[model samples]
Target: MPASLALSPTPAPARGRLWRTLRQWWAVLLFGAVAAVYALSPSSHDARSRNATARLLHATSWQALPWFALLSALISLALIRTLVVTAQSYGLSQFALEMVVRVLLLELVPLGAALFLLLRVALAGDLLPQADPAGGLAPHALAAERWRLELLPRVLALGFAVLALATASGVLALLLAYTVVYGVTPWGLDSYTRMVGRVFDPAVCLALGLKTGLFAVAVAVVPLASALQEPYAAARRAAGFAVRSGTRRVLAVLVLLQAASLALKFL
Candidate 1:
C-alpha cells in the first residue's frame, strides 16, 4: 500500500451530519418563534382568528378553570395550614402570610401552570384534529390552515391560561393566607398589604411575569414543535419516546430560563 493511497481521517461526513442536525434544530426554533409572533401579532387578529382564539380560550382555559381553581384552592389551603402551623411552632407566625404569598404566588403557582399546559394542551395537539375524518391530510398540506385553526389558538390559550391560572391562584392564596393568619378580621388588611407589597415589589412582579411567560413559551414550543414534525400521527404511536425527548427538551429550556432569571436577580 502506497502512503498516498492511505485512508485519511475524513471529518467531512461527520461534520456535515452535525451541521445538518444543528440546522434542523435552528429551523424548528425559527418556526416556533414565527408561530408565536404570528399568533401574537396584529396580522392574526382578524375576526375568524379572533373567534378561533376565543374558542381555544374557552376550551383550554375556561373549561379547566373550575377544576384548577378548586384543586389549587385545596392545595393552597393545605400548604397555608402547614406553613402557618410550622411557623407558629417556630414562633415565626408573624412571617407566615408573607411566606405563603411568596411561596405560593411567586413559585408554586407558576410551576403548576407550566405543568398544566404541558399535560393539557401542548402535547395534546395530536388529539386535537385526529379522530376526525379530515385529519388524513399530509404533513405539508397540514402546515398553514391546520396550524392556524388548530395550533396557534391552543398555544395562545396555553399562554393566557398560565397567566390567568397563576393570577387567580395567587389571589386565592393571598386571601387564604389572610384568613388563616388573621381569622377573617379586616384590621389586618394594612399589615397584610404592607407585607405582600413589600415582597412583591415592582422588580419581583416583573420577574414573576417574565418567568411565567418564559415557562409558557417553553411548555408550548418544546413539546408541540417536536411532536408537530413530519409523520405526526405515526409519532403518536411511538409516543413514549417522543414524550421522553419532549420532556427533556422542555426541562432543559425551563432550567436555562430559570437560571437566567436567577442570575439577573441575585447575581
Candidate 2:
C-alpha cells in the first residue's frame, strides 16, 4: 500500500484531546464531592475565606440589591395583583394569597435566583488550575492557596448570595403579596396567618428549604466546575467545546435535581 494509504498515525493532539475529555469527567465527580464537603460546614470555613466571601457576597447580593429588589417587587406585585384580581372576579379571592405563596415565593423566586447567579458567575470566567503531576511541591502549594483564598471564597460567596437573594426577595414578594391582597390593613393579620399556615405546611416547608438550598449549591458549583480544574493545554486546544460541554453537563445535573424535587412533591 502507498504510504498515504497506510493508516494515518493518530495525531498527538487528538490523543491529548481524548485524554482531556476523560479528566474532565473525573473533575466533575470531584467537584460534586468537594461541593458536598463545603456545604456541610460552610459556616466553619477559614476567616480569610469568610472575609473574601463577605466581599463577594456583597457584590452578589447587597451591591445589586436595588435592581433585584425593584425587579422582584415589580414582578411580585404584577403577579399578586393579577392573581388577586382574577380570583376576586371569579369569586375565589380567599385563595389568592395561597396561590401567590405557592407560585411566586416557593417556585419562581428560587429558580430566578439560580439563573441570575449562574449568569453572573459565567461572565466572571474560571480561575482554577488543573493539577500538574510534574510540577512538584511548589505547584501544589500554589493550587492550595488559590483554592483557599480565591476559589473557595468565590464559590461559597456565590452560594450564600443565592440563598440571601432568594430569601430577601421571597420575603419582599410575600409582603407585596399581602399588600396587594389585603390593602395593608390590620384586620387581615389573622386571616393572613391562617392562609400562610395552610399553604406552608410541614411538608411544603421542608421541600422549599431543600429546593432553595440546592439551587444555591448548583449556582455556586456548576460554573466553577465547568471552567476551572482543567489543564491549560487541553483548555487551549478546545476551549469552546470544553466550556459548552462542561456547562451543559453541569446544567443537566442541576435540572435533574430540580426534577427530583418536583417528583418528590407531586409524584
Candidate 3:
C-alpha cells in the first residue's frame, strides 16, 4: 500500500515534467519560425506586408511611446547639458553637438531601449507570470500559454520598440543639439541634415537596424529560454539561475552582433 501510494505520485510528476518539456520545446520552435519570417521578408509595399509591418510598428510605438519619449528626452537633455558644460570647460563647445549625436543616438539609445524592455516587459511581466504560484494552470499549460501569448509578443514588440525609439530619439537628439548650438533657428537645419545624410549610409543604416532587431530578440527570447530550461518543480528556486544564464546569453548575442556590425562596416 505504501509503495503503491509513493509510486502513484511519481507517475503524475513524471507526466507533468514530460508535458512541460514538450511545451517549452514547442515555444522555441515557434520563436524560430517567427524570427526567420521576420528576417527573410523583403521591405514590402503590398497591403498585407505593409499592414503587418504597420501593426508591429504601431504596437511598439504606441504601446510605450509616451514613456519612452519622455525618458529619452530627459536623458538626452541631461547628457547634452553635461557634454556642453564639459566641452565649454575644455574650450571645445563647438564639438559638443557632434559628440552628443554620435554617442547618444548612434550608440546609447538603442542599447538603453533594449535593456529597458528586458527589464520592464520581459522580466517584470513575462518571466514573473511564468513563475506565478497562483496562476492556477499546470506547469506545461502555463509554459505554453506564456510563450505563445507573452514571450512572442514581447520579443516582437521590443524589437520594433527599439527601432522606433532609436529613430525617434535620434531625430530628437539632433534637434536638441541644434537648438543648443544655433539657438532655435532654421539656419542649422541644412547643416544638421547634411551631417545626418552623410552619416546614415546604406551600411550604417542596415547595421543599425540589424543590431536593434538582434537586441530585441536577445532581450525577449533569452530569459524565456532560460526559464524553460529549468525543471518545472524547481522553477521558483531556479529563477535566479535562469536569469543568470539568460544574462550571459544576451551578452553573447550583443557582442556577436556588435562584432558582426563592425566587421561589415570595415569589409
Candidate 4:
C-alpha cells in the first residue's frame, strides 16, 4: 500500500463509537449496581447520609411542585379535551375515558416526569462538587465519600422526584379526564372508575410499574454516569459532552420503552 493510503486516518472507525456506547452502558449498569448496594447497606442510614439525601430530595421533588403540577395539569387538559372531542365526533365517545387514561396517565405521565427531572438536573449542572482525586486519600475512601456525600443523594433525589411527579400527575390527569368526559357529577364516578380499572389490568399495571422504574433509572443514572466517566481535568467540556450524549441516549431509551409498551398493549 502507498504511504499516504496506509498512514491516512481511517474514517473514525465505527468501532470507536461502538466502544464508547458500550462503555457508557456499562457505566450505567455499574452505577446502578453500586447504588443499590449502597442504598441497602448500613452506612446509607447514617445521619449525615440521610440528611444530605433529605435536602436533595426536597430540592428535586418538593421545590418543583408548583411548576410541575401546573404543567402536568395543562398538558392533561389539552390532551383530554382533544381526545374527547375527537371521540365524540367519531361516535366513539364511550371509549374516550379509556383512551385518555391510556395515553395520558399510563404513557405521558411517566415520560413527562422523566423529561422534567432530566431538564431540571441539566439546568442545575455541576451537581457534583470539584474534588481532587489525588489529594492523598485512598481511592476506596474517596469513592465512598463521593458516593455518600454527592452521588447517592442526587441519584436518590432524582429517582424519587420522577416517582412523585408521575404519581401526582397521573392522579390529577385521571381526575381531570373524568371531569372532562363525564362532567362533575358523582353518579359518573362508578362508571369512570370501572373504565379506568378495566383499562389498567394486571399486566398493564405490572408494565406501568416496570416502565416507571426504568424511566427513573434512566433519568437518574445515565447523566451522572456519563459525567463521572469523563476526565475531571476537562470538567467543563466533559459536562457539555455528557449532557448532550446522555440526553440523547436517555430520550432514545424513553422512546423505545414507550413504543414497546404500546406494542404490548395494542399490537
The number of the candidate with the highest lDDT is 4
TM-score of 1: 0.80
lDDT over C-alpha atoms for residue 12 of model 4:
63
What lDDT tens digits, residue by residue, belong to model 2 across residues 134-214? Answer: 321222233545666676776777788888889889999888887877786888888888888988899888889888888
Ranking by TM-score: 4, 1, 2, 3
Summarize candidate 4's per-residue lDDT along 91-122 as a digit string, tens digits: 99878778889888788899999999988877
Candidate 1 vs candidate 3: which has greater lDDT?
A: 1
Q: Which lDDT tens digits does candidate 3 get at residues 1-267?
A: 687665655577789999965665455455555544544545323455455545655655686677877898888888988888899899997676677776776677777777666655444433333544543233344454344445444455556676677678777777777777678788888887777777778877776777787777676566555555556577777777767666666667677776776687569
**Ranking of predictions according to lDDT:** 4, 1, 2, 3
Residue-wise C-alpha lDDT for candidate 1, range 1-267, written one tens digit per residue? 987678667668988998865754664586577676677677667777778889888877888889888988899999999998999899997787788888888878888877776667535544233322243232334456666776677667767887888788788888888998889789999988999889989989888988998898777666655555434446557556556656777777777877787688777
* lDDT measured at residue 226 in model 4 versus the true structure, 0 to 100: 60
Report how far residue 179 has shifted in candidate 2, in Å: 0.8
For candidate 3, the per-residue lDDT at 63 reads 67
Candidate with the larger lDDT of 3 and 4: 4
Q: In model 2, which runs have C-alpha deviations exceeding 4 angstroms?
A: 1-26, 35-44, 126-142, 233-247
Q: What clash pairs does model 2 have?
A: none
- Can you tell me which runs of candidate 1 are displaced by over 4 Å? 1-24, 122-144, 230-233
Residue pairs with backbone overlap in model 1: none
